[model samples]
Target chain A: MDTKTLCDGILDGQRRALSKAITLVESARADHRVQAAALLEALKAAQASPREALRIGLSGTPGVGKSTFIESFGMALVREGLKVAVLAVDPSSARSGGSILGDKTRMELLSREAGAFIRPSPSQTELGGVARRTREAVALCEAAGFDVVLIETVGVGQSETVVSEMSDLFVLLLAPAGGDELQGVKRGIMEMADLILVNKADGDLKAAANRTRADYAAALRLLRKRPQDPDGFPKALAISALQEDGLAQAWAEMGTLADWRRAQGHWARTRANQNRHWFMEELRLALLAQLTQAGPVRDAVARLGDSVASGTTTPALAVQSALALLHP
Target chain B: MDTKTLCDGILDGQRRALSKAITLVESARADHRVQAAALLEALKAAQASPREALRIGLSGTPGVGKSTFIESFGMALVREGLKVAVLAVDPSSARSGGSILGDKTRMELLSREAGAFIRPSPSQTELGGVARRTREAVALCEAAGFDVVLIETVGVGQSETVVSEMSDLFVLLLAPAGGDELQGVKRGIMEMADLILVNKADGDLKAAANRTRADYAAALRLLRKRPQDPDGFPKALAISALQEDGLAQAWAEMGTLADWRRAQGHWARTRANQNRHWFMEELRLALLAQLTQAGPVRDAVARLGDSVASGTTTPALAVQSALALLHP
Candidate 1:
């Protein structure tokens, strides 16, 4: 489709076209990217800006059934008549440049739902399973009218925190296992979560789940924290993804937290801060590229490193001399 | 030697000189950094290139015996007549910034030893419990012929991971009470740890310690990991820090792991990669500063973001238009 007609359809709230356009943008071909960019521009011009969707990032330990839970939880939300989009980034091949992108199969129910949009992205060895295109994909989802964007990360360290930067809510899922189970995972994930859900909370596991929740709550008291969470309060809830219990409460809790965030102006302020950081990061990449290509500095810098390595010069003097030339 | 002469004397392997120089390098003042950089250059020149040191990073959940174990471990090494430098970053300011550098006090016996250097640098809210200059301090220690440079962190979530990045071996010290205590931590730590020690394994906790180690060993089997770890095999060991039992075994395990890693070429490759990453990161920061100031693209980009917000343009197009002027 031509950019003009394609964008007009998106503005008219045609979900299918929106999906197609997002796919085009996600494609790696140079031509497709150019065409996709043009379509996005036309779409932006024609539509009144839709409400930017709420982004939530979910991360947990592997084998904790992240996809199964997202599938069930997403289906629950769709049943409530809310439009949802799920972006699942696979973390299996983070050290290597491979991704399983298995969410589509794992989340068949949600994937097949007419109102639910499920896209499984490869982390591509990104520390967080959030590829470079993720933030832009998010904008596209919002443009297409996904009220809720659920990003499911391959349960890796640091990726959840990366997702937290892009999302409005960060939910850390824990299995109903006790202190012994939680002890090896390190204290990192706990501090990042605005909400903690003890999954596998069913039948005989209820008491264990409750105890885990209480223990976590006590632990939370000791952590030096900010006043308001991305979600309104510090909430630890119990849910059974397998049994599909407490799912609605989880959804409601998310909504309440999101509302509280918006009311507190945290929603905008946080995004603004993220935007600034992202911009800085982008500029950093661009400028470095320019500097490396600009002049005699590049050659001089490389030679200097060689000298420093061979014990002929110092890294400090090399950097200083290189910077002087580049800036000059 | 006084601080002044000692700072200058660090040019040689004088312990006092090494101590004074580290303090100045880690000092927060602008003038101190200038002095530190100069001293660093001279010291780097005077010392042998790449001093042989086993740089280990120790981190765990709060209440875990990190210091207790380190002291026990350090004392074990000191008794063997190997010089040890413990850069124990103080965490007294978890809720505030004041610090007493009191880990030396925690490990009372080791603190009194002439062969051991136990200095608790303040966390001071740097990237991790590690002060920003901690890397420089580590460089200083390595230059002065310290056999091992041990970095102790505040055991916070993201901070622990960051601390692990600077060390040759990352040891995660976990408590011995192991009835499924793994739920609290995300699975990420498993990937980062070169060694896992279940501490407090003496007395009544012995059974629990064994069980915890068993659980970790089982879980590790499930992970398709790097062909080799920093500490050779993926061995889970149990140790009683209080009783000072398993010190030699633990140290041997660490040595065996390091040997395995060196045989696999990971030791050299890992450090080289880390250095490359830091260079790239520093380049990014320097580039961002220039990019924000050198081009009109910064203004154009911000304006474009506003257009996207106001429904006048799309991000894809904004990026394109902004980049077009990047050449000019």
Candidate 2:
């Protein structure tokens, strides 16, 4: 289908069209890139106003029940007549033995709901490219009338932080444990989380989950909260996806946080800053792409890099020489 | 006067020529930049290989006795027949009600010694420029036959972190403190520190210093050691700058760490990486300078930025438009 037809179908909330459009954006083909950029330009013009969707970033370790929690939480949102969409960017998905977001089997109930849409993470080599595409996917989903977009990232490496950049609210999922587990958590991720959820808070693990929540809460209190966070610091709570317990409370808190952010001017400001941040990043990436594609520039850079590595040429001079080559 | 003459004096370890050359590097005048680059190029060829210098980055909070510790440390190194040069980058020097390196008062004895050379932090507005100049200053010092370069950064803001980028060893100094104080420390900086020292261990603070030392030692144990770290994890020690206690041990440890890094070949690899990193950073800065200085590009960026802020244009599109303005 053409760009107009696909965009119209997306605006009409057609899942298949939205999926196809995402595929176009994710495609690495030169011709497809041109078409994808044109489609995005059209989409931007179609929706001149700011989007109202709540973009929530979900992150957790491999077995932290992220999929289950997201499934339950997604069902709750869909039950409220709110459309929900899930997109992931898991760089390690190939090594971890699955297509990115191949957990459609686990999200079975939500998958059956018409209001719910699940798109697996694209199996892309470049993390930045994948993240850019995922962000564009969020915009398309919003255009398709999805009021709640959940982005689940395998929170181990650099991708988790990138996911947070595109999110309105960042939620970190953790399993209940004592001792070393707390220390094992990356301090960097903890600082980025807007909310922490201790999943699997059912039966025998209930009390342990509560204790874990308290410990994280205390740890967070010690942290200097992000200036953009709402009045209170990051809050921690417990939930059980197996029993579908506390799912309502979790969903309610998400709404409350979103509302608070929107009511204050922070929501708008944050989005604007995000746009500028991405603009600079995209510029850098594009420049790098250009440099690598140009034969003479590429050869010079490699030779200069080797000289730099051997300490024969200073980096400043090397960059100057490379820039000279570019202009010449 | 001439670049060639300046190079000769610098290679001959003339302090006057070295100071003049650093001033040239720090100058914002266009002609000076050209001359500075030429001088650096000449020096690079004059010295066929990378010089071996022990670069130590020392950081501490305002009242944590950083100056006192450095003075004692510098004097001890001088007594050991080592030629020492100290450079600093303090962003808060003005608000802290002092000149950059105001501790020159406390360092009077060391200042009088012919073996020691001290350069105060330049009052540059941009932190990156200051850092760049400081890195160049280190090379100049080495060219002047200074074997030990101690970079003392006011640990309040971003300068401390930048200082770490240019150094072979990063030492974080903290005063005697309780659990709360440890929690108050920035986790990111803690991760970067190669060694942690609890200073001011004289008089009644001795017991508290030891306790703080043990606490930090345990905390450091919890952190994953950097792959570049020579052997064990970051070690914590207690020292008294007032009484000159533990000064010898601290100085000895610096040598041990530097030797370990060099023997493992990490020293050369790290310097290469740093050179590359700075090269990229310099390119970005130079590009930004050009973009802003060009009237059409600057105006276009401002207009696009305003549109992006109002949510009318996406960051990707804005960047593309700006890039077009560049080429056109």
Candidate 3:
């Protein structure tokens, strides 16, 4: 099928385009980029038909079996007849400016499941594995009638909090370890996770996991509750992702939090804030692309850069001069 | 003094006015922001002056003796007649939007020193404890003839990298303990630091500290070196903030990094990049504030939020709709 028809099929919720479209959108070939943008715009319009769908963000350190857990959790929801869409985020090449697309391997089960559509998207050198295309991919998913869209960011991307701006519920997965686990995360991360799950709680580690949970719970009490998670209740939980134990219970807990938020009308306000944030991010990125990629200022930027390095011009002077040339 | 005169004094290298100007800039008074902007504009025009100063950013985890070490370090620099200026980045108040300004108390000795100028500026609800106004404070310090400027951020703020963005050198202080320390900090952060100082390394923990230094040195081999610390070297040292052992050496190492970076032309490049980044950040933030704080669209944004929470409208749709209202 042609690009237009592919996009139409995607809009009509045809499962094939849902898979193919992600690949196309993630492609870097010049023609593919053009087609991807067209498809992405169509997907955006389709999702925009009534309103947008809920975008959920999932993140944790790598090797925590994020894929297996996602598969199980997603399958469970699919069995309940909900159209679950998973947009798995992965790291990219800094020099080549492309993605390895390695997540599809880990998410083999979910990728093969019919009711659960999983798209492992590459981050492509963006700050967070969650990229501009990732946001667009999410639009395509919702337009395709998927109810739940999960975005998984790269494990090592610390400064990439941009997902918070895209997601409705931010769920963090943690490997249940000892008290030392707390030291792994920065306080900023601890403050961001709406629900913290201690994954891999199956064997002899179960007791250690529980102790870790208790320690985190105690440590959490010292932190003022995030106003965003204002249920006035602790939101941390322990689950064995491998055993799939507590998976259903965790989903139910997520529902409860969603209900509490809606009843309190905080969800709307939160999304509104998130939208404003995305708009700014888009502008920042677009401007950066334009400024960095422009033909006219590139040489000047490079030259001024050399002068600044040589101390022939100070930073303030260099910037003043560079922007002047770019803007002029 | 009148705001204009106060700003002039700063530009004229009057020490008193620089402090007064920083206080005025940090004030959220109705007129203070406008006054600060004016002062900044005036200072910007006086760009011809090049003061021999090094901007150093110091960060580490909480209990890493960040405050205590800064006190000892700042005092040492001043004793050398360097005319040190420290802008202690305080954590922002998430709710009240007030500043705690605790740096002075934490650095009682340094604050009371004859030639040392220590200013505890509130971060005011930023992800990093470094306040938006901290840059202004730095500029004011430069204008006031301070030869060395130190910016201190709370380790818990998770914005060590943000503070790292503004300075000539990034000094990451780590406490000596915890077998998990290497794994705790991802390669991204370790790669960003120019120098890693193991604090509280005096006496009992010296051996453990040495092990950590060895482990980190081994680990850093896998990553690209920060240009300022060539030989792919991340200077590792042990210091007891309490005893102030190795304090002078730490300062000397920092000075060496600055000199080397300056020689490599990296110092100017770094500052120029920081300036360009500020411009980019300002452009994005200005637009964000304008959109969210707009009068008509604010309520419409609040209204469209409902469809998003009920899962009736996806976040992307709500955003597009909000933008329609905002732009229309």
TM-score of each: 0.61, 0.71, 0.66
Best first by TM-score, ranked = 2, 3, 1
- Candidate 2, clashing residue pairs? none
Per-residue lDDT tens digits of candidate 2, residues B60-125?
Answer: 777898878878889989999998888887765555557565656768888787888888777776
Residue B295 C-alpha lDDT in model 1: 56
Name the runs in model 2 displaced over 4 angstroms. A1-14, A27-33, A45-52, A57-66, A89-102, A122-130, A153-274, A288-295, B1-17, B23-35, B45-69, B76-82, B89-99, B122-130, B152-274, B288-295
By lDDT, the better pick of 1 and 2 is 2
What is candidate 2's CA lDDT for residue A131?
81
Q: Which scores better on TM-score, 1 or 3? A: 3
Q: Predicted chain A of model 3: TM-score relative to the true chain A?
A: 0.81
Once model 1 is optimally superposed onto the true structure by TM-score, how far is the C-alpha of residue B234 displaced, in angstroms? 6.8
Total colliding residue pairs, candidate 2? 0
lDDT of 1: 0.68
Q: How well is each residue in B1-328 modelled by candidate 3, as lDDT tens digits?
A: 7767886787677768877888876765535755666666666566665564688888776677888888888887888887888875655444433325465777888888767787755546654223456766887788777888888765654566667777777788888875455635545567778888888876888788777766666666665555466674677777878888898888877777777777898877677677656544543343344345647655666565554444454444454455445445
List runs of model 1 lying over 4 Å from the truth.
Answer: A1-20, A27-135, A141-328, B1-8, B14-20, B27-38, B48-50, B59-65, B72-82, B89-100, B112-114, B126-132, B154-165, B168-274, B277-328
| Candidate 2 CAPRI classification by DockQ | acceptable
Per-prediction DockQ, in order? 0.16, 0.29, 0.11
DockQ, ranked from best to worst: 2, 1, 3
- Under CAPRI classification, how is model 1 graded? incorrect
Q: What is the lDDT of residue B305 in candidate 1?
A: 62
